[model samples]
Target: MRKLGLGLAAAALCAAVPVMAQETAPAFDAEAATQAYMATLSGAARAKSDAYFEGGYWLILWGAVVSIVTNLIFLRLGWSARLSAWAGRRTQRPFLRSLLWAAPYILIISLMTLPWSWYQEYYREHQYGLSNQSFGAWFSEGTMGLAISIVVMSLLIGGLLALVRRYRENWWGIGAAATLVFVAILLMVAPVSIAPLFNKYSPMEAGPLREQILSMARANTVPADNVYVVDQSRQTTRISANVSGLGPTIRISLNDNLLNQGTPAEVRAVMGHELGHYVLNHSFSLLLGFGVIILLAYLSVAKLVPVLLRKWGGRWGVTEVTDPAAVPAAFIVLAVYFMLATPFTNSLTRMHEQEADVFGLAAARAPDGFAKVAMKLSTYRKIEPSTWEEIIFFDHPSGHTRVSTAMKWKAENIGAADIE
Candidate 1:
C-alpha cells in the first residue's frame, strides 16, 4: 500500500511539471516587437533623419576636398614658404620660431574654414533645433576652440619641424614613434584637461541611480568610482555618455542632455553600453588599432611625400620632403589618406558598438529602453540605411539594427523580465 501511494505521488508531480513550465515561460515575438519599435517614429521624422545623415556624408567628402584644395593653394601661393621664412628671420630658437609661425598658420586655417565651420556647426544645428546656443555663445566657444588649436598645434608642429630638421630621411620612422607616445598622452589628458574647457562636470548625486550604476560597474569590473554629469544641453540636444580616457584617468561621464531627457531604464541601457566599452577594454583596443592605422598612414606618407616633392618640389617652393614649408603638402597627403581610410575606420568602430549593444541588453535587461533610446538617437542618425551605406558611413549600427538587436534579446529572454 505504501509503495503504491508513493508511485501515485510521483506520477502527479510529473503531470504538474509541464503546467508550471508553461506558466513561467515568456511569450516574446521578436519580429513584432522590432516592428512596433520602428513604428514609433513618424514618416516625416524618419525622412528628416535620413536627410541629415546623408547631408553629413556629402559634407565629409566636400570637407576633405576643401582641405586638400586649401593646402594646395597655400603651397602654390607660396604662403607656406613665406611663413617659414618669416619665422626663421624672427627667432633663432626653434620653439619660439615654430610658435610664431604656427600662430599665423593656425589663424589662417581657422579664418579660411570659418564659413564652412559656421554653416556646419552653428547654422545647421540651429536649423535642426539641435542647438540652444546663441550666436555670442557660439562665437565664444569657437574662439576658445581656436585658441586651443593654436596651443596644441604649436607644440605638435614645433616638435615635428624639429624632428624633420634633425632626421631628414628617417624622420617619418622616428615621428611615428613620437606620434604614438603623443597619442597616449593626449588620451590621458583629454578627459580632464581638454573636455572641461567646454562643459562643467559634476559628480552624479548619490541615489538609487548612482547605486544602480555602481552595481553595474562593479559587475563588469569597470573600475569606475563615480558617475559624472556634463552640461552638454547648453550646446546641443544630444544625449551622450562615455567611459573615456585610459589608465587611472578613466572616467564615466554622461551629458546633462541624457539625465534630463532619458528615462531611468534608458539611462541604464546607455550606462550599460558605456560600461561594456570599459569592461571589454575597447579604449585600449581602439587606441592600439588606431595607432596601427596611423603607422600605416605614416609609412605611406613616407613613400608618397618624396615622390610628390620630386614632381612639384620647385614649383611649390618645397625643395624636399623635410622642408618646414612642406608641412602643408604633408598635411594634404595625410588628409587624403585619412579620407580614404574612413570607411574602414567606421567599420571597426561600428563592430565594437554592436558588441556593446549586445552587452548592454544582457547587462541592463531593458530591451524596450534600449529600443526607445535608439529611436531618440534617430534625431540625428538615420533610422535605417542600405547595407553598403552602413558599411561605408556609419560608426554605429543603424537605429533599425539596434532596435532589432534588443528585440532579439527580448525574444530569447521572453518571460525573464516578469520573473525578475
Candidate 2:
C-alpha cells in the first residue's frame, strides 16, 4: 500500500509539471516591447534622423517650386517655342519633330535644373551622411540618368504628340492609356536593363543563407531560382532589397549593404517584406491605382490646357495643345496636379507597405529581427512622428509604427516554436 501511494503521487506530480510550466510563462507585453525598441534610438541619433526626414518635407515643396519655375521659364522665354520651331525645320513628320523638340527641351531643362538637382541629390544627401559617392562619381551617374531620361522622354513625347494630333477631342483618354502602357514597359525592362547600368549584379555566393532565401521564395511561390546582390555600398549605405519587374523579368535583389550589415534573421525579415510585395501583386496594383490618378490628371489637363492656350498661346507661341511648344505648359499643369495629389499617393503606398509588413511578420516569424531592422532604418527615417505628419508625409509606416506592429505580432505569437 505504501509503494502504491508513492507511485500514484509521482504520477500526479508529473502530470502537473507541464501545467506549471505553462502557468509560469510571462505574458508578452506588446506596448512595453515596442517602447523598448523605440528607446534604442534616442539622443543625437534620433535628432539627426528627425532632422534629415523633416528637411525632406521642405525639399518636397522646394522641388515642386523649382520644377514649376523651370517649366515656366521655358514658357516665358519662348525657349520651348524656339526648340519646337527648330525641330519643325529639321523634320516634316510631326512625330519626328516632337522627338527632336523633346530631346533638346529635356537637355535644356536638365541644364536649367542642374544647380537645384546638385543641391537636392548630391549636396543634401552628403549633408545627411546618406551618400557614399564623390561629386565626380555622382555626376557620372547623373549623366547616365540624364541620357536615359532624354531617350525615354523623347519617345513618350513623340507618342503623346501623335496621339494629340490624331485625337484632339479624346486625346487625354488615349494618352493616358498609352502612358500606362509605357510605364508598364519601363517596369518590365528596368530591373534587367536599366538597373544593371547603375550597379553590378552577381549571384549571391553559395551558402546556407542563399539556400534559406531560396527556400523562403519557394514557400511563398515566388518564381526565383537565385538571389542577386548589387554593389550598392559604393553609392550609399542604405540597406535595400527589391523583388522587381513583371513576368519574365522578375528579379530578386538585395544590396551589399544589407549583406554586410544585417544578420541572417534581419536579412530574412527584409526579404520576406520585399517578397510580400511580389506575392501581393503590389507592383501591378500600384500601377493600376496610379493609372486612375494619371487618367484624372490627364482629364484635368485636357480641360484646362485649351482654355489657357486660347488666352496665352499667342504670347507663348503655342497655337494649341497639339503644338510641341505647349509641352512645358502641360507639364506645369501636371506638376501642380501631382503636387496636390501627394497625400493621396503617399497613403496608397503606405497602405501597401503596411500590408507587406503584416505579411513579413507572418512569413519570417522574426518579430525581433524585424524590429531591429526598423531601428536601423531609423538612421534615415524619423522613427516617430506626429500622427498627422505620418499620414501626410510618410510613404511608408514610420519606424515606431513598424516596431510596434512587430511587437504586436510577437505578443500574439508568444511561445510559438518558430518565433525568434
Candidate 3:
C-alpha cells in the first residue's frame, strides 16, 4: 500500500488499543465512485493510465540507471566492509578475519539498518498517533525482527552471489528476476509462518458475529478453512483482516484488534474488501505482473552490471559479489532499482486494488459497510486529492473517491445514496 496520505497509514493495519467508538463522520463507497471516475478520465489522464497499464517503460530505464549509479558509489566507498568491521569491533572486538567470514556482506547491511526498524516502530509511529508501543515493547520486537532479517538477508545474498559467480555476465539480470519470484512466494506463505513468530493466532470462537462472518464466507464461496483471528493486540491496536493464500490453501485471517475495535458492520466491510481480493485473485495477478517486471529488470541488470563492475570494482577495494564492502554497494544498487520502478510496480498493484474494490461491492452487497470501513481509515489517509495527485500517489482509491463509489452504487441499486 502506498499510504495514500503517508506511510503512517500502513501501521493502521495493526491496532494499538482495544476498540472504541468513533464520532460518526462520513461514508466511503469506493467501488462505484472509482469506476465512474475511471470512466471520466480524458486525454492525458487516459494516456498516463494506459502507460501505467501497458507497463511503465520509463521505470525500467530508471531502475537500470539507478542500480548502476548506486553500485558504482557503494563499491567505490567500500562502505559495507567498514560498517561490518565497525559493528564487530564495537560488539565483541571479534577478529576482522572471523567477522568477515561469519557475518558476510548482507549480514552487515542488515545490522546497519537495525535502527530503521526501531525508528519506524517507536518514534515515527508514536509521532503519528498510530503506535502505542513502549520502549520494552519495541526492544523485544526489534531483537526478534533482527534475527529474522539476518536469516532472510543471508539467504538472499548467498543465492544472489551463487548466481553471479556461476552465471557470470547473465547473473545480475537473472538474479533480479529470481528475487521478484522469491518475494512473491514469501508473500503468499509468510503470513502463516513468519507472522506467528511475532504474534498468536486462534480460531474465532463460536458466536453470532463469528457465525455471520463464516456465513458470509460460505455465502460468497470464500474458503472456510484457515479462518483465524490473530492476537495482533499483543503489539498495537488497529483493525485489520485479510484473505490470503491460493486455491485450497486460501484462508481468511483477521487481527484480534478488528474484532475488539470495529463494529460488526465495519468488520464485514473490511472482510468484504479482502474477499474482493480473493474473488478477483489479486495476488495471482500481481505475481504475474511482477514476474513481467522482473524480466525487464533482469535484462537491464545483465547488460549493465558487468560493464560497471569491470570498470569500477577495484576502485571500491572490492571486485567480487562476495566482498563485504561490495554488498552494501550492491544493496544500494538493488534499492535504487526497486525505487525507480515504483510508479510502474505500484501501478499494477493499484489496478488490482481497484478491481477488488469493485468486486467487494458486488460480493459484500453492502456499500454502506464498505463506506464505514473507509471512514475508519480516513485518519490515516489523504481524504481527497487533485486528479493528478491520485494518478501519481494513490495506490488505493482515495477515501473521498472510495466513498463516492459506494454512493454511486447505492444510487444505481436503490435510487438514492443519502449518506455523505
Candidate number of the best lDDT: 2
| Candidate number with the higher TM-score (1 or 2) | 2
Runs off by more than 4 Å, candidate 1 = 1-26, 93-96, 417-420
* Alpha carbon lDDT at 260, candidate 2: 95
Off by over 4 Å in 3: 1-104, 246-248, 320-325, 415-420
Which ranges of candidate 2 are over 4 A from the true structure?
1-26
User: Candidate 3's residue-wise lDDT over 1-420, tens digit each?
Assistant: 222322244335535632231112113344645554445444654454344433334444544554455445545576644655565455542233333433544344445444654654577556555666788987888777777766666666657666766786678567877787678667767777777788776788888878877877777777666678988777665667876665556677888878887777667767777777876677787777888877666665555555556776667655555443445544454566676677677677777777777777765667777766765555455555577656665677766677787767765565334322
Which predicted model would earn the best TM-score?
2
Clashing pairs for predicted structure model 2, backbone only: none
What is the TM-score of candidate 1?
A: 0.90
C-alpha displacement of 78 in model 1, angstroms?
1.1
Task: Provide the clashing-pair count of each candidate structure.
Answer: 1, 0, 19
Residue 391 lDDT in model 2? 89
Task: Count clashing residue pairs in model 1.
Answer: 1
Question: What is the TM-score (0 to 1) of candidate 3?
Answer: 0.72
Q: Sort every candidate by TM-score, greatest first.
A: 2, 1, 3
The candidate with the higher TM-score, 1 or 3, is 1
